[model samples]
Target: MLGAFVDGELPASARETLEARLADDPRAAARVAAWRAQKAALRALCEGARVSGEDAAPDAGQAGAEPAVLILRPSGSWWWRAGMAAAWVAVGAGLAVAATMLVPRLAPGLAPELMAGAAPTAARSETSEAFARRADIAYAVYSPEQRHPVEVGAADEAHLVAWLSRRLGKPLSVPSLAEYGYTLVGGRLLPGNTGPAAQFMYENDAGERLTLYVASSAVDRDPVRLLRDGNRRTFYWSTERTGYALSGPQTEPKLREIALDVCGALGGKPGQW
Candidate 1:
């Protein structure tokens, strides 16, 4: 191990490990110093033994015996080699960092929309907090109305579904909350953060209401998420290229129960809840 270190034959990590051991062990450090000194002496002896020709006479008292023929490298050459290797590694890391920071800045002509899928930002993926807030706002605006709560009444359920599916660029289905005691009142068109949104409203016997807001989502899939606004709550998730936010005034436990059923009916995974 000591010979490999002196010859610079060990890999960097192994060299570092051995170096640490040497620093803490006086006997090991002594061995390294002795090896270095011995190498220097051998290199000096080899250089001084150099002669003009192979036919030269042997030294005075050593006649008929071979002269010193060992070839030794200078002690400092290994350190020089190690320094060049480290410099090359540093240069490679610098190039990688520069590429990451400069590539996008160099291409100013690329449209933001064209790069949307390549680099999805928060704008493309609206957070659950914003989704829930929008559902709450839509419900607050329309739920109080008696005659115009919806743009299309439930009497034309088929038309409303078809119209919404076309506007959002994806097929949509409304899951009945009737089992949880709310009946569908109707649905309407609304503006979403990124595109057109659809809102389907429902009310129970006591007139308390809920709204399911949906829009085109870049998010392929996500687990169910819940959000709370002062007097309201929302259970939201993204699935099958669409985002759904259900807002109501019910407690979290009650709303959670209703949200799971709604999720199952809309083909969302049961484990997501």
Candidate 2:
């Protein structure tokens, strides 16, 4: 269990089970810590070797300079060659460790716990919190785009809503935030875990933008909640047929007010602030 945890190969439920046991067993916790430390050391060694090799490489501008070369002379004894072979094997092992650590970072949309060398906690299917986190990540990824931020603009709001409604299998509406100094900028269609989702964007005169992410859900009752990730605050809720998340870089109190307005416009009850 400790090895799998360090390698980030454990399933979420099994990892949670191991973590619970570790909390009660100090010795197991210590072992896990040692494993993490060893992995870190191996990664550092591999990085140092790479940096050193890069530093030793000839610069492109030094074209007139002689290129450096390394030549290996075999010793007379068989044991000497065997020892060198073993050293190369050790170096290969170190490189493998570094590559393992880099794989998660290079992969798209990897869980934070996996990249951090920790096990992820299990989540229920179509949970509101999980949906909110996904919405937040999508907002963070797309909100900064200077071009092509949305698939459809507010100039075509009627068509955009109709298209998304057909894809999501639910009636969709765009909330008006004109009272809050925000005008509809545009909207976009996004792929959700269970089905298609829609994102409606609004921008104020100051250029600050906010987004409403809506998708179909099976929950019959409202599961309204507020979540904060980095500088963004999201208020999420679910109805019998749809889930909604409003995310922006605004104060919680202000975002909550906007969330209420959005809920009211959508004809859903907003959670008490």
Candidate 3:
């Protein structure tokens, strides 16, 4: 009966069979919990990590040494009898495997590299730097000469905040940059596999432009970092509480200075921005 449960083939008959066996044996319950936890750990590891089916099974002699070793070997009479019931259990286990997977795909944490990448890129990495760069490029191509800054304009600041906040899963505010000699032209909503995204445009007196790309963190498991790539300098860093990526074209020192001011205004320490 315990073997049937471990094989994930426990059907009504198996349950009836196991009920009698388990009723007299306390170890059966412990085994079931252990197997469940084992399934859970396997599912969690699979969230973003790739694996081959061959490596999915637990080693035989290692069984019960750790609950994670109780690999569900779905076969034989057990699965045949239970069918989809076992499938539903597997799905429930999968959901428990990772709450981050349940977040809206557009809401951030889309790519693992930004989170797992080396150092600062990893630290300040939100969902995807590629997406951030793509977003910046898209804005650069489309927003100049008032070609079209946004689907929504500054007049709709309320809608802008709510819509972007919903997509990013983080509170967002368009920092008033008028003090920095820039005025908000407007903002645009963008597509992201991890979640909805937003870009706020600010232009100075000389027509110099800067866009703030905001999104949710892909992982909160690490520190913040600053990344410089191509023609852009990004002050990417994360707080123990959250993550942020600020990228622009200025020199590293200038970008760093701006990042410091922005971080200060955003209630984060300047050293991190």
lDDT string for model 2 (33-124, tens) is: 99878766655444433333346544423423333444455658898889988999999999989877886678755646565765433342
Q: Give the candidate number with the greatest lDDT.
A: 1
C-alpha-based local distance difference test score of model 1 = 0.81
Per-residue lDDT of 180-263 in model 3, one digit per residue for the tens? 687877777776535566777777888777677665555443333456557766665444334455666668777676666766
Alpha carbon lDDT at 24, candidate 3: 66
Ranking by TM-score: 2, 1, 3
User: In model 1, what lDDT does residue 137 have?
Assistant: 86
| Candidate 2 Cα errors over 4 Å, as ranges | 1-124, 271-273
Candidate 3: segments with Cα more than 4 A from true spot? 1-139, 142-145, 221-225, 239-243
Residue 32, candidate 2: C-alpha displacement in angstroms: 38
Task: Give the worst 10-residue stretch by lDDT in candidate 2.
Answer: 59-68
Among these predictions, the greatest TM-score belongs to 2
Residue 118 of model 2 has an lDDT of 59
lDDT of 1 by residue, 96-189 (tens): 8886567678865554444564544564667666776887888788888786889998889999999999999888888988788999898999
TM-score of each: 0.56, 0.57, 0.46
Q: Tell me the number of clashing residue pairs for each predicted model.
A: 0, 0, 18
Q: Name the lDDT value of residue 44 in candidate 1.
A: 53
